[model samples]
Target: METIQFIHSGWAYIVLIVLVIATFNALIKFFGNKEFDAKDFRISLFTLITMHIQLLFGIILWFTKGYFDEMSVGEVMKNDAVRKLAVEHPATMLIAVALVTIGYSKHKKKLVSKPKFKVLAIFYTIALALVLYMIPWNQWF
Candidate 1:
């Protein structure tokens, strides 16, 4: 379980970096009116992979931390720190991963450059925002 935590924490850096790069790439290329190229495809795919891996680790870490054993919803909600780690972090991270997933797939199906960039920009940006907002920065850092 400690190993799980270690891996999750370490992997978070990669996830953050890749996601930022992908989002920025999408935005820059979209605004530049550049064609979505193979590099773009690879970056988006890599971001999706990185995020899903983090989400999997987070779920495992959450369960091992015994958050479900929390006696009641109110009890869990009442404690701000525990609540942030146990509930808010995972929930928001999950949403972020889902958004990245959707963005990757949606962009893939688009035939043209602008729509591809638009899809990736929209969802990946939202995912990045959610991730940045929800990470347990106090504890993790």
Candidate 2:
């Protein structure tokens, strides 16, 4: 359990770094009217892969922690810190992952450079925002 937590915590840095890079790359290209090429595709794909792996780690950590077994839903929700760690973090991260998945899929379907970048830019930015917002900054640092 400790190992899982450590890995999940460590992997979060990679996920955040890739997500930021991908989001910024898409936004910059979209605004600059740059062509979407193989490199761009690879970056976005890599970000997606990293995020999915993080999600898997998170799920495993959540189960291993036995949060639900430790407390009732009401009991967990009553405490701010517990609620944040047990519920809010997981739910928000899940949504962020879903956004990344959707963005990747949408970008793939678009044939034009501008549209592809636009899709990735919008979706990834939102997902990045959520990820940034929900991260347990104090704990991680």
Off by over 4 Å in 2: none
Estimate, for each residue in 1-141, the C-alpha lDDT of model 1 and write its tens digit: 899999999999899899999999999999999988999999999999999888889888988989758557788899887788888888888899999998998899999999999999999999999999987787685
After the best TM-score superposition of candidate 1, give how far the Cα of residue 25 lies from its true spot, in angstroms: 0.2
Q: TM-scores for all candidates?
A: 0.96, 0.98
Which has the greatest lDDT?
2
- Tell me the whole-model lDDT of each prediction, alpha carbons only: 0.91, 0.96
What lDDT score is found at residue 79 in candidate 2? 90
Total backbone clashes of model 1? Answer: 0
Candidate 1: worst-modelled 10 consecutive residues by lDDT: 67-76
Q: Per-residue alpha-carbon lDDT of model 2 for 26-75, expressed as tens digits?
A: 99999999999999999999999999999999999999988889799999
